[model samples]
Target chain A: MDHIEHLEHTESPANMKKQIWNTFYVLLVLTVVDIALYFALLSSHSIYKNILFVFLGLVKAFYIVSVFMHMKFERKFLASIIILPMLFICFLIWLALTEAGYTFDSRLF
Target chain B: MSNTATLSTDNKQTWGGGKSPLSISYGKLMMWVFLLSDAFTFSSLLVAYGFVRFTFTTSLPNAIVKPFSHLSHTFTEEMQKAGLFVTERWPSPELVFNHFPFLHGIHLPLMFVSLMTFILIFSSVTMVLAVEAGHRMAKKEVEKYMLWTIIGGAAFLGCQAWEWTNLITEGASLQNNPFGPTAFAALFFIVTGFHGTHVLSGVILNIVIYINVINGTYEKRGHYEMVEKVGLYWHFVDLVWVFVFTFFYLI
Candidate 1:
């Protein structure tokens, strides 16, 4: 018998229809939320606007990474490896951004 | 790489028939690495954009720019109709992509970009369908879904071409833009363009899979393992776009 006769075992998505519909559903909802927030932020200012924006942005990002990217189904160790770097980089980048803001306040351009 | 080794044993050969016995395909593995690197590249671009945005002459693109303030209200009103989001002064996605021919100020490249994002998102959905079809031994349906995926991939490329054209057009040149921060044009063009290139190449690779699928290449070869791997790549592209949409458009 030829080696080709043996079966090839590839991974399959856990729940096809459910995953697809749910991902679209969440994304649709977020887009709506974003639109609404756009109005609220525009009319009258809120002290907590920045916090709200960041919070909502994270929610959207989370769904993309977890559901769309299938990170939720990914192995724990592998997922950790991916997220660890992302977290660290975001932190360092924040510091750099803050430094950039302060640098502009100083002397001549 | 041992001669006796086969995909059935280690699950490497399904990736592609290259060296020793392996289960998965090489192309799929490489795509993951490339995507990871691309992720870092975007991070750096965003970080640099942050620096530029902070140092710019104006208060900020989103905070100032009063006309954009109007769209914020429009978006809020629309969201209220849908019952999906909270409303506020929405920044005009139009000002960002105002160069298109027919849809100039009427919700352009943003609408088209949303179209592109949805195409990729839907392709990911179809890709899963194809994989399932393959597993069920439904060759006709497998080919049907695969073909639809290829068309989806192509449509996304066409959208990108329009986007790039609008970006590089006369008024919208890297030089001028009524809206956006100083570094806004440069960062937006670079980030979005790079992502577009990735989508373009993915279309070609998908074309190859489509060909293989029609020829029943995997059937005789056994197992549609490559589908899983490529599906990952497609989904990742969609994933990245979701962030791009949020950061560049709505927010």
Candidate 2:
């Protein structure tokens, strides 16, 4: 019973509720911004507009992971174990988009 | 001095047997790792979307149709006639996903998806709140929040079903898309379909957890870590939606 009780991990701050709502508002605002930017930049069709949208998405992602996911309070070692591996996704995006541009060019001209 | 040496021993003991060095429960840690692997799966799908999307030319500018403008019954046909929907270029998501339930012939571009995003995000918030309540051993609070989370999840699924129906009615499928490219419809269905399946499962899991909460399972066990674990999965579903919204509708 002692060992089983030890397996129960509970570590949350008192103001966690406040933090949750704040993060909710932040996500809400960021999503509204996402839509606003989409329409504002509709006619441009520039790569920078896409990057801007992606950047906003990443901001929203950070808040969700850090607050709602309770990652901010987790141990550094645990956080790294879960987050560090995702760096490969960045590399994959870069590689894929780079190749895609070449494919587009080859097919076009 | 010897105090430093004792501290080193204490640190070593943390890594030694009889303790969890990471300070997380075995099940919760497993949940995190599972979410990480799941994140990778979603990332691969979204990245593939980006790759395929980047290969296609951008959609032509639509200066003719403004938001809130009255749409005709032959909207897709008119767009195709106007060269807005073609095989050689990608179609703007705004034009493709403009229909909302019961508001036909209205050019409300990304509004429905934005509502979907809000639904998923609000559900995620409720889920975390349930986890927070579980920490306090507030059984009633946990039950209420879990129910809300389930409702949010269900509402999101309904919204998706409606959107999917509208698209299918507009003649979108795996092999055929009246929109710009067939691949667009295919990828849209696959990515959002995959994410929708996750939401469905999350709702099911939330229902299970809600039942357990009502039955006082966690209260009897003296911990709500199960809620926390499921909370992580629910949040992950929301996280994937953020990207899906970015790649599919916003981009």
DockQ of all predictions against the true structure, Cα-based: 0.29, 0.65
Model 2 ranges with Cα > 4 A deviation = A1-10, B1-10
True contacts kept of each: 0.32, 0.80
Q: Per-residue lDDT for B1-251 in model 2, tens only?
A: 33234335788755655667677888989999999999999999998999889889999999789899998989999999999999999999999989888887899999899899999999999899999899889999999999999999999999999999999988999999999889999999999999999999999999999999999998999989899999999999999999999989988
Query: Could you estimate the TM-score for every candidate?
Result: 0.71, 0.95
Error of 2 at B134 (Å): 0.6
Separately for all candidates shown, the number of backbone clashes (residues 3 or more apart, or on different chains) is: 28, 0
Write down the worst ten-residue block by lDDT for model 1 chain A. A1-10
In the range B1-251, model 1's lDDT, one tens digit per residue, is: 33225423755554454432223245644655666766787777666765765554332223333331333324323533443221122224534543334543443324565566668777877876776677776778888887888888888878778876755553344564434433566667777777777777777777888788778888877766566567767766666676676656654
